[model samples]
Structure formats: structure tokens, C-alpha cells
Target: MSRRSEEKLAERADLMVEEEALRDLAAGGSGLVGLDGPGAGTAAKSAKAKSGGGRGGKEKDPARPRQPYVPARGWPGAGGGRVGYMDPPTMWRATTVQACGMWPFAAGSGSPMTGVPLGQHLFTGATVCGDPLNWFTRARYISNPSLFMLGMPGLGKSTLVNRMLIGLAATGVVPLVLGDLKPDYADTVRALGGQVISIGRGRGGINVLDPGAMGEAAARIGGDAGEVLKAEAHGRVLNMVAALITIVRGRPMDDHEQSVLSAVLHHLRERTPPGRAVLLPDVLRVLTEGPDRVRAVTLDRGSDTRYRDAVDPLHRSLLGILDGPLGDTFASETSTRIDANAPAVCIDISGIGEADTQLTAAAMLAAWSDGLGAVAASHALADAGLAPRRWFFTVLDELWRPLRAASGIVDRIDALTRLNRSLGLGDAKITHTLKDAEALGTDADRAKARGFVERAGMVVCAGLPKTEMEDLGKVVGLSRREIDLVSSWSSPPGWGVRGEDDEPPGRGRFLIKVGGRPGIPIKVAITDAERELHNTNTRWTTNEAAVERAAARIAREVARPAQEGPPPALAGGPAALALPGDPGFPAVEASAGGWTA
Candidate 1:
């Protein structure tokens, strides 16, 4: 035997020993590969017999075969049938402070649960609540309690604001829609049992000289607070007069002109009887009379001619507000005073034509002055403990009109935005787009207007053109995804089918951006009760007869057989379907079984 022959014989003996060990294990012996002791094999077999394969323990049948492995077809793709090697990802919720330690790299803890519950988070499917005032005073998430909302027309800008108004009203926050251009909030205000003060030609009116709720508040809150309220009320009237002059003259009043006007207003207020509101006509009368106080401010030097010349321009403008295109809207006593204690108040200026930009601007300025004065008075009374503490939600819709109407209006709104927090006011500024600010006359006005967005606690944006995203990004720090999402919402509507109205792609979608954090995209969902109140397009919408026809057409379509094909064309061309209102389409009527043409 050579060396190679001895090696082959040794390998054969080792393989035989391994095969015997495997056989013993299959017969229920210990699984240790090389262990072949009689005691080990007997112990393993006894354990296997005790632990039977059946539900109840029973002796194992040696003749029974093991169950065969069956393959499963799961989701399509490689490894689809394989069992998961690891558990699926899970979500654990915690407060922001706890989340910092748990997920240091996490983007956010989703939208805050505080504030007004607007709608669901577009991405996370979580309920998103937001309100600038609530966030500022309650959650303390933002420094300022003001919001800026911008979007395109017909995209539910007014609807979203109405939602916040309704929510805040429920939370005991009064909603004051200072200037409702399209009367968008009138119905909602009425439904909320609020005051809807209309101001337009042949409609209602607003007396610019009236102190509104401030007078009552001042009397109720006597002492230093009362004096402060009176002073603030006086200042508001002065500012409103100045703003109106600026609008009419297409230029702001000079220092001397403002002084003369202020002096005239003061004289008029002094002579007015208690509980009697001042009117614009009274101010004009005082200026005409050349009172000593007015003359001193104008530096007439005791010359009647000098006094008249000094106030000639101011007189003409005030006269224009009374008798010009503005008509009796501002000259007469206010038709309906704003009820500060009401759930909401909407100054509907939509009765004014859209072409009358200047008049609209003046009306807006006056409404804002009156509304804010009421807010200030409310705060003063609450502080004095003479009235219940109340929070006001101010809606400044069609913001561009006022900014463009008068440059002075910008300064007024700027001051309001700054002092909103201290005054217990949550301001919401709504406009078509950011470009509206850029369209202002002067660079200073444009910059100040843009600050409205910058200083806001949060910016809620709706369907806007791609062109708007560039300018909006500068103020809101929008990410590419957010920009794309917002721009996508501006897509045009698709063709209507089955007698349904064609809705805009981004009708109720909004992106709420706060600071540099990721945006919260929300789709506003209105309740059934709000459906009729939220319709801002009543002018362009179909009449009742057309609506009934549409309803019948829809009923016919629903009852029609699914297998029914398109109607035949007039000629031997491709079959064409007749639209609901098409002339050739047949009228639908109800039958015993269903609707029929």
C-alpha cells in the first residue's frame, strides 16, 4: 500500500462515521453531529415523543411523512414571497421637547394641534390647526399674531379666511372683516348672527367722523384708560381723514395740511354734543367757518382769505368724498354701527363697482380705521375690567386696493401689524399675489407692503402662478417642492362632464409656511352649512332654472345604462355626446323606474 492509497481509505472511514451520526439525528437522537452515545439517542427520542406534532400531545407515527414546504405568491417583484427579515417602520409621537431627544434629525413633529383646526395635513394626513392669535397667545409658537394669505382669484381665498373666522368665533374671538370687497363674508357674518354693514351707492353708509365703538368704550372705561381711548380715537379720525385726502388728491397731505385738518377735527369734536356722532359735513362746515383753532394751525395770520386759500385743497377733497363717485357712503351717518360684542362683523364694500378703485380704497381705509378703533376700545375696556376680555380677528381682504389707493394707507397698516400682539388682535391680510405689493407706486410703499408678509406669523398661500413663486419665495423661504406644489395648484380647470361644474384644480388647497420650517399643505374642507355661504361667484353662477336643468341632466346620466354608448352625430361622422345644456340634447323626465330622456 502506497501513501495515496492510505489517504483514500482514511477519508472513506470518516465519511461512514458522519453518515451514521446524521442517521441517528433524523431518528430523533441528539443533533450534536458527532455524538452517537446510546443514552443521548434514547433521551432525544423520548423528548420528541412527548412533544408530538398534533395539537394535543400523542405518540408520533413513524409512518407519517413531514409536511411539504409550500411557496407563496405575494406582491409582484423579486423577494415578494420571502418573509420580512425586519419589522416595518413605526411612528412615535411626542411633544417638541421630547422629539428633540428622540429624533434629533427629524424634520418636525407635524402640524401643531393648537389654534384653529383648519383641515388635514396634505402629506401627513394629520389634523392641522392654525391661527396666528391662538398660536401667539396660547401655543406661543409664533412671535406675532398676524397672517398673510395670497393666492389667485376663484381659489377659495375668502373661503379659507371664512373658515378661520368661524373657528375663531367659536373660540370667543370676534371676527371683524374690515373690507369685504366681493361681499365674500356677508353671508357667513349673517349666519354667525353678526353685523353686516353694507357701504356702497344706494346701499348703507359709514360716517368717517363717527368714533364708532370707541365713544362708548371711552365712557365705560373712565380714568387714564378712558383718556387714552379718547386720544387714540381722535388720532384714528385724523389718520382716516388724511388717508381719504391722499386717495382723492393722488398725493399725501403735507405736514401743515395735516395739522390744519387735525385742528379742524378737534374743534368739531369739542363743539359736538355728547352721545352725538360727528359727520364729515360737520368737519367741512368747521373748516368753512374758519374757527380760531383751525386758523391758528393753518397760520392764517388773522386773514380770512389766507385761511380759505390754506384749506382750499383740503376742502375740495373732503367735498369730493361727500359728493363725488363715493356718494353718500362716507358722508352720512353710519347706517349700522359695528356691534363689537357680536360673533362677527363684515363691512361689505362689494356693492361698489370694481372699476371704482379710488372709492374702494377710501371705503377700505375707513372700514379699517373704524374696525381697528373698535378693537382698541374693546381691549381698553377689557383692561379696565369694565367689559369682558375679547380677542379680535381682523380680516383685511383685497389688501392691494388700499395699498395702491393711497401711500399713507401703507404706514397705517404697517403700524397695525406691529401693534397687533399687544392690542389682542390677530390680523389676516389677503391679496391676489405678492406682486400686488410690488405694484405699489413708490419703492418705500412696496417695501412696507412686502413687510406685511415678512412680519406675519405665518403665510397661507393658495393656487398661484409660477411667476408668483419667485417673489413669494423671497419672503417665505419656500423650498423647491413647496414651490412646485403651489404652482401646480394654479393649473387650469379640466373640461366638465356629467353636468357637474368644472372646479379649479387648487380650489381649496393651501400651503401654510411658518419661518424656515417645511410647509404644511392643507386642503380646506367646508361643512354643508357653509356651502351656500361660501359662494362668492353668485354673479357668474347659473340661475335657478339652469341649476334645475343641470340637476335633471345629472339624474338622467346616473339612471342611464352603463353600456349605453355616445349619441349619434348629425352626419355620418364619429358619435358625439350632447352636453347637458346643448340645444340638441333632449330634456330629462322622471319615470316609474328612473329618469329618462
Candidate 2:
């Protein structure tokens, strides 16, 4: 456009703003143009007189200002009232700009004040940039550093992730899975070209990290605990390790350096002992590999440093993990050709409980962290622009369990959130119990979890119990009436998907958020084996040991019913669903002593 055209547009915009301001003054005392008293009107007139114009020679009615804007503070709602915002002569559309650029602010549209476009959001896998919630439309969100996924059994946390992989597989972005419980699903992941090693399973498998491991790993190089590491102070060490990793990037601690750390830990143990300690395999790996293994680096002077140069090389490795075999291994798969496709990876955690959850989660987190570090160091982790298209997702169905495990897990997780994103690695954590999240991890881990939820680029809640409804309502800035919308995942199709959108239709409905919007309601699909996501549901009856146990249980309980009751329509306890069906509908026949077949 010509300069004259641009100037005309600017003038029009200014006129509109001035008109609105004067209108606001006439309408209410609280508007930006509001009058404090009758004297306020005289003051304005006097100012205009001093300027030699009542209305800038434009329109000479008794009201309205000649200038479009005038900066001043101390006004209500201008960063002074109960809920004040920045004090400035902001454009009317300023909210639109600020809303889009800021992270974790109360959800709102973009502001002209900040001039950031409130564009849709997408997920950034280790090597790709795209939307994580692809199956359900209208919930586009830019991949923020945080993501929260909640659901009950069979709620598609895994399945949807697979769809996400399919959507962005070409981007070469990949993720490191932190905690996928069902090792049986390894094949599916391998098909995606991801290199996954299960930790906490056995000796050959990655061992579940433990506090003892922390102490052992530390002492291996004959390092001192600038403070000693005690199990009782697990949480502190976990936080320290996490804080240190973010600083050190997995650099190794020299012998004397170890001693200093031990001393620092020992000092903290005496002065402020933690409730528990969680041992992270990643931390152990750093100490074992001697620090050249991990990525982030911070000198220990302020926190202490210069022990060994570990973080820089670790950062280099991260680029490889995100771009190489590990990237594919951590993703979902469609065929035996591991590199050909990337699939969403999710694990079913219906049967696992807290303390027992550590091992499984460690496995998944380990894989994910490795992949994310690689992605961040190279191409995928840039703060601006789209993630390089290659993307992979790891969905943790019951994440809180592992986080709550000994204190060591907390910092490791924070490290995941703090450092892992951007390289095409997205950690999708689904939980039934925020309380589990609240109670289990060290205070630091719990804080990290909460921080994640608060700043999530996208958040969806469905079918929550009432207490959860109340708790989340406050967290997301929802009203009491909105709280009633939450329900369980087991509910029908769209029952409780509530968030920044209109009441979504169907049972088990969910509200979807994208960059400060509550735009639409969406459905969280259930798992049917035929769907894209590989369901890691195991049949106890199908297992050799489980089959033997069920067979034995059949001998003791569940007697053959008399002629009175109808033939059982469904599968039985001792005879799990995996058993062959009596499809012929043959008449009842006895077996063994009860009756000969």
C-alpha cells in the first residue's frame, strides 16, 4: 500500500480508539476514559484550552479527546486494582498480542499491546513440528514446553499418540519415552526405528534406578559428597541432581568434585533432610560414563563446576539420539522396517500402583530423555519457527507413580521438561489422580508437575471426580459452574471433555485448549485393537504361568453350575477371554469327574 494509504489507515485506527475511549467515559467510571469526578471534565477542558484546541479542531462537541492516547498510571485495572494488568496506554487490541506471546498466563486472545499473533499450536517432536491432538480437530496448539493428558483405562492416550506420529512422521522429529510400562510393546516401538532399552526390568534390561544406585554411582569414581547422600534425603538429592543436570548437562564429577558434592549433600541431609530419594538411571549413567555423557552445562562455582567436561558432548549426543535409531525406537511402528514410519507410543498402566510404578516409568523416561537431548542439541529445539517436521510422541498413561517414586525421579523429570522438548520429543503424561501426582514425587517433582499443568501449551480434562473438578477449576481459572462439567473417561463418547470451549457433545467429552483458547469440545476415543494405536493389553489366561494359575484356581473355585443357571454368556474368571469360545453353542457337557465330555 502507498504511504498515504498507510497513514489513512493509522488515522482511522486512532479515531476508532479515541471514539471508544470517550464512549467509555460516558458509559462508566471504570473505563480507561473514566472521570474521577466533575473536576475531571474541567481539567480536560483546561488542558485542551492550553493546547489551543477544544477537540483538536476536528469535532467541537462538548466531549471527546483531541488525542487518541495519553499515558498515565494509578488507574484501577491499570496494574493497580485487585487484578491489575500492565500500566500503559495500550491499544484496544493489545490483549491479543500479549496473550499469544506470553507463556502460562491466564488464557486469553492475543493483544495488540504485544503484537504476537495468536496462531494455532502444534507439537514439536524430536525432529518434527505438528499438532499432538490431531485426531480431534479444532484443538491446534503450538508445542509449548509443557503438555498434560488425563484419562482412564482404554482412553486412547496411546492410540491418539500413534495418530500424532502418523501425522508428523516425515519431520524426522523423535522423542525419548520416559516411562512405558509394558515391555511387551517393545516390538511396536522398534518398528518405528526407536532404540528402547527397558530399565528396571532385569540385569540385561536397564535397571530401575534406586537411591542405593545413586550412592553407589557417586562413590564409584571415589567422589566425595561435598555432602553425603542419604536415602532419607532422597528428595533433596533428586532436586539437586535435577538442578545440577540442567546446569551440567550430564558432565561427570571428578573424584574431588564428587567429594564436594557428597559434602554438600551431607550438609543438606543434616540441615534439611528430604523425605525420600529417587535414583535416576540418567544420573547414574553420567557418573558411570564420567560426565562427557550428558548435555546441559553450568559451572559449579555458583553451583560449583569445572569438574569434567560432560554437558557439551552430551549435548552433541542428544542431536544424534533425536536424529538416529533411538528416535525411531521411541516412536510407534506400523511395520518391521523400523525407520520407515513413526508411530505414537503409549503404555497401559491400569494394573500398576505407586511404589511399583518406578521401574516402568524409568524405562520410558530414560528413552525419552535420551532422544530429547539429541533433538535439542541439533535442529529440532529452536525456540522460533516450526520443529523440523520429524516428530515422535511418548504417552505415559500413569506418570505420577514414577514421579512419586524415591526422590531421585523428581529432578530427572524436571530435566525432561526443562530440557527435552524442542528436539521433536513430546512427553504426554496422562493421569487419573492428580493427588497421585500431588502426593508421590518429592516436593520438587510435585512442583514440576504442577508447573507443567499450569503452562501446558494444550490441556484437556475429562470425566474427573468432583474433588478433581474443584482442584483443576481453580488451577485453570475456571468458575464453580464450570467445575460441574468434569466426569470420568469411562463415560460415553463425549461426556466430560471440558475446557476453553463450548460444552462438547457426547459422553466422556473433553475441553481442548490451544494458545489461550477454549475453542471446541472434543472426544477422546477408546481403544479397540483394530485402531491405529497398539493396545498393550495382556491376557493373563494367555500367559503360560497365568494360564497355569487360572487352571489351578478353576479346580478350587467357580464350580460348574447346575442345570438351573443359563450357560454363561461371557468368558469366566478361570477361563479368561483368551480361551476358545464354545462357538458351536453345543449343549453343556461335563468334563473329568464332574461329567465326561
Candidate 3:
């Protein structure tokens, strides 16, 4: 009720009076309101009357009709509004303008609780989900540059790997399983698809393949099977000797020591007339030319002349046998072509000691990689003779450290990584700890594991204990949220993620990192159909096929009368039988005791 308040009230009253006059004038506003010039101002203000002014100070009727604004029933034109905000983010796929903050919906899942909204019909032919993105088709195993599967025991890794490989092989994709497994795995592989090697026992290796005018496999070995074996064995032996020396010395030998050993081995193989290779000729060539020569030239300068003299003769004899006898058998033998698109080739070195495992692992990995590389190269090769082959991921499971003896895995990783990509092959290596990986390098380099994980393009971490999770986080560059996903405390089948809508990463859940694309967590399809197609668990029932075939054959024969017509009938019906109580025909089912008879 102060002066300012009174003035505001007075002003409001005047405004109402003017509004009334304006309305009244508007009804028939043409005449008086159009007074000329100065007079018009006076006419316009005719209703600007205060509470009481001039003509009367007495209060007007309290309930006098007062003009009210129609559209003006809005905010008062007094002060400006204070800034305000919107509500919290509640629904997924909700609008951003009215949002509080968003939490990730379940990533790449179709579970009622976790499934994120999909666009529609992206995967045209896929039948699983109704998502428009067509995740099934787009995320298929074929589309990926490579697929990698890693799991703890009983997680069904090998089961799926073998099954899927077999199925693919049957498609004429060519499947070759080179791993440290007994005949059972091979048998299972064969049962699902392509032929398997019979090297172990009678199962026999793959039959000689018609490489279809592509002598690619033969070219690698130079001439025949013995040559290939010899080359592989030589590399393996050299690798083994290196590991043995490393184990004995507690360290890798210096360049000089290596040189001396090489010289001695070389001297024995070449200085004598018996040095002509009788077995693995290719291997003998590689050994004598580069390896032993380098050693002889370098180490002979020191006190290693005696070493060379002793080992040289035996080396030559072995090389000669490898060149002659060994080469002959392999030359006449045939080759087997397995699938070039397997997801894994498990190289189990369980029985071997840590030192020997290094040699075997290196040699085997090298061989598989070379084969895959050859396949891929053949495909991309511009030559008309070369057909591009589809290569897949080469995953190593149950990876063991070579007892601080073998050598730097970094070198192997580097070589493999280069070759893997060149041949369209991916490498997924599984190890228990970061330290274990670190130990595989000879130079005590810390970045060995880091370099590997970084180059892998995709790194999937599962069942990580807390401590190991922390350690992995440091090297893997995973964020706090991503680390949480990896170290999830939830039981199997839960998933955790960090990006847009994070959740617990669970069993059958995997995160893919494709080049520069965002990490996509996927709920893999583990259905029976998928398993049957990918892993080859579905067996062909010969009995059922045979039954159908037999029925059809029998029907056709019966309808046409295979005997040209019906057999002789009982001439006078039942009375025509010569024997008194003879049945015209015997039971076919029981005839001669079996169908064949």
C-alpha cells in the first residue's frame, strides 16, 4: 500500500477506462475518434479518467462493467522469467529436448529387459529378430573380417569351433584343422564335413587333392612332400635348439654364440660329400645356404673352429637323406585342402615341456599362417591362375608361456599380425595374465602385450577377476565403464558396457571393435540351427535316406513287374496245389531270413 503500489493501481484503473472507451469507439469508432490533428489526441484520451477526476470525485458504481483482455490473460509484463530446465531422461529412444540424462538401454540384446530399439528390416533374410537393422545378416560370421571365440572351461569353445568348421568345409569352402588334437577332434571334424588327415592312425590324411591347376601349396614346399616336411622340420629343429639353449643359459645366447652354433651345424652338412640332401631337400637348402653359412662365416673368426668340425659331417648326412629318400615318398603322395575359413586352430602343447612347446608352437603357427596367407594371396593375386580365397580368424586358446626359455613372442606376434592381415586372417590370443604375456618377450620389453592387444583390432575380455581387470585396464586403454563391464560381478548371462547404454556383459555376449567404429556389444545367436550350420552338429541319417530310397525302388519294380509279369498262379485256385496243405507264397518278411535273400 505504499506510494508506488498506489500509483500502479491508479495506472491499471486508467488503462481499463481507456480500454472501455476504445471498445465503445470500435463499435462505431468512425466519427468522434477521427477528430483532426490536436483535437484527435483529446478525443482519444476522453476515457483516461483517474479514480475520480474533474467531473466527479465520488466513486463510480463498484460493479461497473469493466473491459477485460481476452488474449492478454498471460504473464504480467513486469520482470523477466528465471531460467528453467527440463525433466530427467526416462524412456529409451526418447527425445533429447525434454531430457534429464540418458542411461544406456541394454546393448545389442533382444531380451525383454535389455533389447535396444532397432530401426527395421536391416538383415533382409535373417529370421531371428524383428529389428529393422537386420543385425543377424549384417553381423553374420561371414561379414566379419574374422571371428574369434574365447571362453573358460565348459564354455563350449571347441565344440562350436569344430562343428562350424565342418559345416563350412562341406560347402566346398575347404577346411583344414591343424592343431594339437587327437583323432577324435579330427573325426568329429570329418563327420561334419571335409576329409581329415590320417597321419595319426588309419583314419588317414586327406586324399590327394586336385588343387585345380593351382600349384600354390606345392610351390611353398618347392617340389614334393618330403621337401615340405624337411623345410618345416629344419625350421622346427633350429627353433627348438634355440629354445634349448635359451633354457640352459637362462637367457637367449648372444649373436656370437648363435653364430658359432650355426657355423658348426652348417659345416657338418656341407663340407662332406654325404651332405647332399636325401630327405627334406627344401629344408636342407634353407639350412645350408643362409643359416649355417652365416654362422660359419661369423663364428669361425672366434674360438669355434673345433665346434664346426665335430657337428658338420652328421649334418651333411642327415641333409642328404632328407633330400633323397624323404623327398621321394612325399613327392608321390597327394595333398589335402581344408577349409580356409576356420575361426580357430587350437595348438595344444599341453604335453610338451615349456621349452619344446615354443618350438612346436612357433613352427605350427608359422605353417598355418603360411597356408592361410597363400590362400588369401592366391585370391587377391591378379594372375588369372590365382583365385582369391576367404580367410578367417586364427585364434589361439589355452596359450601357455614357454617357461621363460623359448624367446620373444613379440617377434612372433609381429610376424603373425602382419601375415594374418595380409592373408585376411585374424589372431586372437588368450592368456591368463598380462605378466605371462610380458614374459614371452626376450628383451624384457613391457609393451609386448600392449602392442599385441592394440594391433588385434578387437579385444574381448571375459571372466576377468578384479585384480586382473585392473591390470588389463591399464594396458588395454579401457575406460572405467568398459573395465566395469569386463570385471562384472554378475553371474553368467549378464553383460556390462560403458558407452551409450551400458549393461553387464554376459555369457554369449561379446563386444566387437571394428576398425574405427564404436564398440558394439552383441548378443550372439547360439540357437540349434545356427550351431548346426556353423558347427556341423547335424548328422546325415543314412538309414532314413536308405529307407526312402528302398521304398521307391521297390514300388517302381513292383508296378512294372521285374519278372516281366506275375509269377505262375495256382492253376485251379486252391484246388490246383499239388501238395494238400501248401500256402501259395511264403512270408516275404521272413523269406530266406532276410530282405537280400
Candidate 4:
């Protein structure tokens, strides 16, 4: 072509070729410039399907009609809908103990299996058990074989005590519930063929001057140690009596008065025969009479007057104990003996009330002293290898009330705690809180009381108030986490709720702090019969049938005048009275259902 005409012709020719290629691509010919690759036709089909169009050739397929895109709506801003991936801010650092504490599944090693099986651990399914005496003698996991339990009422504190005592009893370890507020131990005592000494008006009494405890004290400490322990035992009894005076007098004992009381107890101990139980009346006799040789001993008449002054207050104090509400319970000889080998020897002090603090304190002290003696006797047997190394568990139930009631109560408790070690005894102090210990008289008294908490080899705590939990931590060396754990235990998830939600700490649930081990949550369980026997929820329910029967019998007797004629000779034996489902009468269980139409 000529210059300009040739170029125009060339451009027209190029346009024609491009137009042909576009027409072919529109017809899915796959012959376009970039569409000529090996997988070019497959890619074309994918694009055609995505655009809602029909494909071409063997791979041809009908594309589904596309729906218009609609965005989800919510609170405005980019925060709506599925969120975008965001980077983590930072990694937190924590120690293993701290880390594990945050997570319940993570727990430290369990307590050594040195004692009786108590219960299953709350976190792990491992078995948790503890016996202070066992831990003490082994010298492995614990320092002392004393236990302190803190929990609210109805949290199974006393019930757990009963279980421990009975469990030990089965192992040939004698058990003694020294002071019982709920008094549930009585039935257990009776069931185990043990005696239950109930101290109340017209009930069995304890001879405070009984030599059994002293004798055991002497045996537990042989030779010079025994002499020292014997003297301690003597002093304990004297102090115990003095505390009783202080409780009754509503104040602490004067120095001179205390001396006079001690001298009187000493004289009574010397004069009383070993075979006879030294009664409170005997001590009372000494206090009032002031000894026959007292006049000769005094160098001056003023000395006699001073002696009189000391003796008068003590004598008056003695009179209150011997003639007050406790008179019937303590003035006479003990009706029951301390059988060291018995399964249990419970002193039912439930009859003694808060108003009768003096009586309760005196009764508890007496029972505790007597229990120590029994434990001592058992130890002697165990030492000779005559017995299977028997030990005793001495339980101090509702320890706080009596602790607050008397001035010398802490001293008596301290003595018991000390003497128990040598006497083959494990002391368990059952109370609500550590504050009870701190509530003693002076700072020194409070410190002494606190010693009980510290000396305890194991601490079993249940749900406690936040304040009480903190107080417990401070007094007994509980960690911050432990205090939080205990306080949280105050109420479990959905506690006291109905249905499956009712996850309250029903019974025997406690946080056990043993030696240096981490806190272990435990749930103590027993058989149905054991539950019935150990049910100490006095305020909730009781032996309704027995109570009703008693009331009915009393009513009948009151209504029907007695014209005394052999007093209606028994038609049937004692069995007839208690027999369930008799011919004419329904059983207690049936009667418990209430009057039937």
C-alpha cells in the first residue's frame, strides 16, 4: 500500500482480527489469546459458573442463579457479625501453685495414707484419711496428734467426730466424747456397749477427785516424768475445780483463794481411799472445815485471820458448785467407770446449758481428766505388748461455750493437750471458729487457747463466714488461697436449692489442712445405720416416736391415779414396748407417719 493508505489498511486489518477473537471468546471457543493454556477451558467454565451463565463443550454445565448478597445487621460499627482475627495481647505469668489454685483440677500431692480412711478428696477421686495419733507416732507428716475442727452448726462437725471416734474404736482405739452438746454420742456409746455418763439433775455425777486420771497420768509418765505428770494431774484437777469456782463466781479466782482451794484438793486427795471415788462433797468438806491442824501451823492469830479470809471465798465457791444446778451431777460419786478398752465412754454434758456454764465447764473438765486416765491405762497395756498398741480419741465437742464460761478453762485444755500425747490420746477440739479461742480472758489466756489450734496436727474446716475464714487463716497459718477456698465453701454452687441444683455441703464435707500438705476437700460418708446413730442435728429433727411415747405415758400416768396394786405387773418383756409392727400397735416407724384415718 502507498504510505498513509497502506497504514490505514494495516490498522483496519488488525481491528478485524481482534473483533473475530472477541466473537470466538463470547461463543466459548477457548481460542482467545490468554485462554489457550492446558487448563484454560476449566478456568473458563469456573468463571462462567460464578457469573450465573451456561458453560460450553464436554465440561458444560448449567450455573445456579445467584442470589443478591445481603449483609447481616446488628448494633452498628465494624464489631458487628463474625469478628476479624485479632492478635493476643500478652502471656500471663504465674507459679505452679498459684496456677494450679486457679484451676480446681490442678492439686498438690495428697496426704500420706498413714491413718484411717476418712473420705474421698473433693477435687481428685483419691481417698483421704487422717489420724493424728498415727501421724504423731510415725513422726512423718505431722508434729502433734491434736485436731481442731471449725464449722457452722449443721455442717456435720459433731457427726464427723462421732465417725472418727467410732472408726478408731473399731481399730481397738478407745474413744471418749468428753463434752457432748448435741448428745448424739450416747446412742453410739450404747450401741458400742460403752457407757454414757449424763450429767444433769438426777443424772450420773463425776467425782472430780477421782484418782483414775491421776493414776493414768503417773503411768503415762514413768519414773520422774510420772512424778511430774502426777503433780501436773493433781494441779490440773485443782485448777479445774478452781475454774469451776471462777465460772460460778462470775470472775477470776484470787491468788490466796486459789492457794486455799489447791491445798483443800490436795488434802482430800491424800485422805480419800484409792478404792473409793473422791466426791465433790469430800472436797467441799475440806474447804469448809479448813483442816484441824491449821491453828497450830499459824504462828500468829493474824495468820489465822488471813487463812480464814482465803478459805471463806473458796468455801463459798465450793458451796455454789456443790449446791447449785450442778450439785446433783458432781456432788456424788461417778455412776460409771472408765473402761479403757471400751469402744466409747461418752460424757453427755448436753444437759448442761449455756446458763449453766459453770456446770458444763466442771463436767467437761472432769470427763476430760477421767478420759486421760483411761487413755493412760491403755497406753500401759500397749507398752507391755499385752494389747495391740491401743490409743484413745478424746473429743471435746462444742468447746467454745465452755471455753468462754470459765477463767481456767484454757489452762485445763492446755494440760489435757499436753498430757494426751503421753497418754496415747488424740485430742479433737470441735468448735465454730478460731475466734472462740481468741475470745478467752486476757492476752495470755487467748494465746494459750490459740495454742490448741496451732498444736493440732490436722485442721478440718467446713463452710465459714468470710471474716471467720480470715481470722482462722491468721490464727492457724492458713494461706490466702486456703482462706478463700474455705470461705467459698461457706456455700457451694446452688447450695440448698431443690432438684439436682441442691448441691449444698450436705454432710461431712470439709477442707482438711494436714501438716504441710495443701488443703484437701473431703466428703465423709457413712452407712445408713451409722447416719441414724450419728445424726446430731438436734435443732432440726429428733426421735419423735420415742418423745411422743414418753409424753403419752406420762400423760396417762398423770391422769390415772395410782391405787398401788403391784404396779400392773409386766404382761410382756421390754421387747414388747419397742417391738416394731406388733399385733395391736404400729411400729415407731409407722407411728412416725402420723395418725391414720
Clashes of each: 0, 131, 54, 1
Clashes of 3: 54
Against the hidden reference, what TM-scores do the models get? 0.71, 0.41, 0.43, 0.64
Candidate 1: C-alpha lDDT = 0.81
lDDT (0-100) at residue 89 of candidate 2?
A: 70
**What is the TM-score of candidate 3?**
0.43
Per-residue lDDT value at 315 in model 3: 44
Residue-level lDDT tens digits of model 2 in 1-597 = 997786667666556655766765675422343334223455666655666674455443466543323333223333442212446574232344666665354544331111112212222111112254332222334455345766555444555444444334434435434455553334555566555443332222321122333333233323233123324234433333333332223233344444433443343334333433322323333443433212122343332134344243433443343343333322122111112123433232223334443333433444433333333322322222322334445555556656654444555556656554533455566666567767852566677777767766666665666677677766766554445554533344444456443332323344454554442344434334424236456543256887789898986566645435676666654445443455543356767678533
Which candidate leads the pack in TM-score? 1
Q: Flag the better candidate by TM-score, 3 or 4.
A: 4
lDDT of 2: 0.43
- Reference-based lDDT, residue 126, model 4: 71
lDDT of 3 by residue, 355-454 (tens): 4543344333333433443354345332334334454434344444432323444455556654554444444455445556555544544455445555
Summarize candidate 1's per-residue lDDT along 463-521 as a digit string, tens digits.
89887897789878998889999999999888777777888899889999889988899
**Model 3 residue 352 distance off true place after TM-score fit, in angstroms:** 5.7
Alpha-carbon RMSD, candidate 3: 21.0
**RMSD (CA, Å), each prediction:** 15.1, 25.3, 21.0, 19.2
- Can you write out model 4's per-residue Cα lDDT over 1-597, one digit (the tens) per residue? 687685566566545545655665676654343324223444556776666664442454554333221122223235553223446676333446768666345455655566776777776657676677767776467767788898977778877777777767777777778777768788988998887777766667776666665565466557775676568667757766766676678887887666666666666667766566567777666655667543233222556676666567667777888778767876777677776656678888787666876676777767766776666555554655555676677777778887886656678788777766666577888888777777777888888887887778888898898899877776566788877777776775564445564545544688888766678788776778888787666567777999999999998898676644446556665555654455655444337758743
Model 4 clash pairs are: 221-226
Q: In candidate 4, where is summed lDDT lowest over 10 consecutive residues?
A: 67-76
